[model samples]
Target: MWIHKSRNPNQNFKRGGCMFSIFLWEEKDVQRGLFKMTCFSAVEPKQLGVILKDMQRIKDGYAWFLDGCVFCIQPFQNQSRYSLKGYRIFFNTSIETGMYLYDITLGLLGGQISGIECVIKCPSKKSSDWISGLRSDTSFQMTDPRGLFNKNGCGIIVVNDTVILQMRNRNKLKVYEALKKIDSIREELLSSVEYDLFSCSKEAG
Candidate 1:
């Protein structure tokens, strides 16, 4: 059961319908009294090392994760007659101590390439960042091949506690399919997410 933790709605990005997120519990306790909640921001690859260095609450606010098989969606606000909502996909508890790993190239890869130089770039620009995060996490795994997250990858990170984050990835096919699969029973998960968000905002005030 993931919850919303947004305060001061104005700081959020535009609600232009292209926004999404998947975050975690990010709370700020002030003098052990009033707690403030501010969403976390993205850390560039150069800054990813710093994020991992801090063992602070990660579920606080993570953008997304993309590799090959493992992927996550970010949460965002809605703009229809004043509305705020987000989504989440709960993973089974079978996930082990380590994370998942995968490889996603642009065009057809790992096959005979007629044009050697003109072949597809190993990692596409769009999904390169998030996927890079997954690759980095795998690097810290306590298993074989410490730095073998490069192509033709393996191990799908399929489990984690419900995390709340802002949707950043624009892969329509992946986003639509993932959302549909998880919220099938509820049909529209955002509707419920919106209600939760509204409640959280009131509580914050």
Candidate 2:
């Protein structure tokens, strides 16, 4: 829970909906608790070094390991043409560590990165059934402009024993709130399910 009082007293923050814009604030603005805008530019090696330093500063005991890179592609309409849409860097981290790392990574790389998706492991539950229920439920209807949702019409995807959540919001504050909402939804959905003691014990060990 990263909490910050807004500098604008009149700004009313509304709950629900996914119409958040990119917010790029300077260090001074951060000190003043104000949101600012950022421009999209090519990421340099020095900038990446700075991001690593920043990550080290707040990482605590959490670690974000590089998993792999995915090549993103876009196909042209009614033509045999395709465009390369940059590469997506994948990272592996524990669920507890992922919560904050997701937000921090987005904040640091939002200007250069177009989108971020979190793949949560749901080993105890059937991901297909869970995602189907979420899609059929009216409460989880999230309009996505990126066309990243599955055929079920939600910002969620089921892949084997994992559930992928597409997080499109670039603002760190909005991302934090969304994460809290996601946790609440997860609890509500899994309330009836029995706790996986074996999994807990394995993690603890």
Candidate 1 lDDT, 1-205, residue by residue in tens: 1222343212332111312133221122100111111112222223433443322223323222222111222222332333322222212111220112101111111111111000011111223333343355533232323211222121221111111121223222243233233223122222434454688799999
- Report lDDT (CA) for all predictions: 0.24, 0.36
Give the root-mean-square deviation of each candidate in angstroms: 21.3, 15.8
What TM-score should be assigned to candidate 1? 0.17
Q: Quick one: how many clashes does candidate 2 have? A: 0
Candidate 1 regions with alpha-carbon error over 4 angstroms: 1-107, 110-190, 200-205
| Shift of residue 81 alpha carbon in model 1, Å | 56
lDDT by residue for model 2 (67-162), tens: 221111111112322432122333333324443454465335543333444444443556555655556666665344222243222256555534
Give me the displacement of residue 127 in model 1, in angstroms: 28
Candidate 2: where is the Cα deviation over 4 Å?
1-42, 50-114, 132-138, 141-154, 169-173, 190-205
